[model samples]
Target: MKNLKVNPSNSLKTSRLVIRIFASLITLFYLIAFVPKLIQMLLGDAPERPPGADWEGSMVTVSFLIFILGYIVTWWRGLVGGIIIAIGSILMFLTHMMSASGEFEFLPFFVFSGPMLLCGILYLVFWWKKP
Candidate 1:
């Protein structure tokens, strides 16, 4: 083939960097939030609560897919995925709160919800700020 190369400009490079570093980190965090449950499930244990297990798994998987799609598309959807994660976290918290004998603990909430909120903020600050 003849000499032909498609080179992305400087801005494209910078955007890619943001998506890979910021978006991907957030996505990974959200994914990690599910690992304890996922590990339990893999070991034949059910979640203490089950409303969002499947949804959370799907969201984590989709967030990873969005990172993969970054080569072709913007990683903006990771922000949306992060929002979904946060909502799921809230719903789970509410369900637990409404339970007759549930206790409120901060670690679970922080691990799941905090990363998601941060993900949204990072996306807004890094990506949405300009576009």
Candidate 2:
């Protein structure tokens, strides 16, 4: 295979563009998933508490904010934000499991953590490839 390039500068710019695209996608996904929850919290219309202060939801909120900050920093920090997002995802998964076993089927784990986990995995993969 030919390692063809219009020029080294073009190749570098292309690489940066790819990274930025991935970062933006991650940011957009998080924003779409989290903004509604934050609005609900602000409007004092947050969902019903899940037995114990809704720690899972709280983590999701905090991790989303951290991810936003990470986007402002560097992609590496953004990767850290992805890790926080993954933590939130894990908490959400646990909450769902607990809620299921507690004789009730309730929780918004799918909406709350699904994107977090997916974006975390996607960005983590990108971060690993980044030099």
- Residue 80 miss distance in model 2 (angstroms): 2.4
Which residue pairs show collisions in model 1? none
Pick the lDDT winner: 2
Tell me the TM-score of each prediction against the true structure.
Answer: 0.43, 0.50
Tens-digit lDDT track of model 2 for 14-99: 76566567658757876776677667767878785522356645654565565565456545465686576566566656656665
Question: Model 2, stretches more than 4 Å misplaced?
Answer: 1-78, 100-107
**Residue 17 CA error for candidate 1 (Å)?**
4.2
User: Which 10 consecutive residues of model 1 have the lowest summed lDDT?
Assistant: 65-74
State the lDDT of candidate 1 residue by residue for 1-131, as single tens digits: 79976554666557647646764565566457556766776776764753245554454445434433432233446446445544544554554455444677676556544554454455434444453
